[model samples]
Target: MLLKAKYKKNIFFFFKSLLISMQNFLKQFKPKKYKAYNKYVIVSAVYNVEKYLDDFFKSIINQRLDFKSNIYLICVDDGSTDNSANIIKKYQKKYPKNITYLYKENGGQASSRNLGLKYLKENDLNIFWVTFTDPDDFLDRDYFYEVDSFLKKQNNIAMVATNIIFY
Candidate 1:
């Protein structure tokens, strides 16, 4: 229990920094429209992850590609005792077409991710590549562009880890 709480706190801190940084970065951003949702984004959030949502949203909105529909947003609320579910629902209503919000029983992060995957598979969403983002992590707008381009150039690649700045 102690380790879990510690990790969650660290994750929360990292997530908070990400949001603040994104807010700062968002003061100057331009969208580049794309054809469709090119990559699948798996963002798993649980109780006490509220600190990171702002940064996650900011990072996503500032993505270089213009077409917001092309990127799938899978936000799973793992039976949050807090207002996590309500928060996710708010975003879902805001993005009824592009985002998916799942509220499952109080499970851990892994279970929540599995549920998100189940939703994807059930809905028959064909994803060429997949990546994960923590509720408290921030992403660079250019990160997707660089990764997608690199993957396309190198066909045999399966999975890769780029970078993350933890608190």
Candidate 2:
């Protein structure tokens, strides 16, 4: 009887430790949640854009903006034949809190944009503003700052457009 009791305790402890370790291992796979500020969603459609991705990423990440606003970048990979998806993934990993990368079948730019919009709606991000950009295009460093300032001062505007300068 003493031997049986000791075996049962050992089995129970073994299972308990196994369960604890399993939970700990699963915790590493859990997705992280980020706090949203004056949440702004920047959506982009990427298709075979590997060559331009680095500059696009650098431009977005380098934005000089107030901390009161948070930028959430959502890029839809519309069946990129090249390394565009991998490039986006690199940025996503680097800025996990600010980037959401999506993959979809070969769709045109509009379809990719629609998918991104749907994702924003489904996630219910409570977004305050939205902006779009092409993978080859870059924005000014103070783009978001100026946009945020303008929107704060204006009450009736639904959309604002900035002058685009092509070089």
Candidate 3:
């Protein structure tokens, strides 16, 4: 009985040490930042915009493009105390491949945008163009498609801005 108990204790300690080492090893691949593998990445920062998320997300999801895979959306939530996070999560679930969500402590919009840019830089996304929008804003259905077409045709253009129609 004494020998059995001693062997059991030894085995338990060995497994505990193994588990700790394994956890540390796995932390290396925990994704320091998200990878953007698309041609155009749209980064939007949100804070407690649950009321407007639906419209914002609808505009994004309804974008018309011949090559739909070229566009990506990155939404960063800056410590929203409302249901904004949940709304973003719902959209993420619906468009897992197109949308990337980042959650951070309450910093202002600039900080959130910086985090998005950091993610793109750290992950080496190599995207051709980037854009930003407010969570309460609307995007036209041909937004990405038009932008892609225009950029492809213009060689000297560094950036493009569209006219906004406010309600």
Q: TM-score winner among the candidates?
A: 2
List lDDT for all candidates, in order. 0.72, 0.82, 0.81
User: What's the residue-level lDDT of 9 in candidate 3?
Assistant: 67
lDDT of 3: 0.81
Clashing pairs for predicted structure model 1, backbone only: 15-136, 19-55, 32-66, 33-66, 36-70, 37-70
Cα lDDT of model 3 by residue, 1-167, tens digit: 23456547688866676799999999998533222223788889999999999999888766665324666788999999999989998988887877889999998999999999999889887886889898999888777777777776778887889889978
Q: What is the lDDT of residue 158 in candidate 1?
A: 78
Best by lDDT: 2
lDDT of 2 by residue, 1-167 (tens): 23456547688876676799999999998644333324578889999989999999888777776322478899999998999989999989988878899999997999999999999999988886888888989888777777777777878888888999989
* Candidate 1 ranges beyond 4 A from true positions: 1-37
Q: Per-prediction TM-score, please? A: 0.73, 0.74, 0.73
Per-residue CA lDDT of model 1 for 53-143, tens digit only, reads: 8778777766775426557788888776766667777877887776788888877878877888788888888876666677777778777
Candidate 1 TM-score over all chains jointly = 0.73
lDDT of 3 at 98: 75
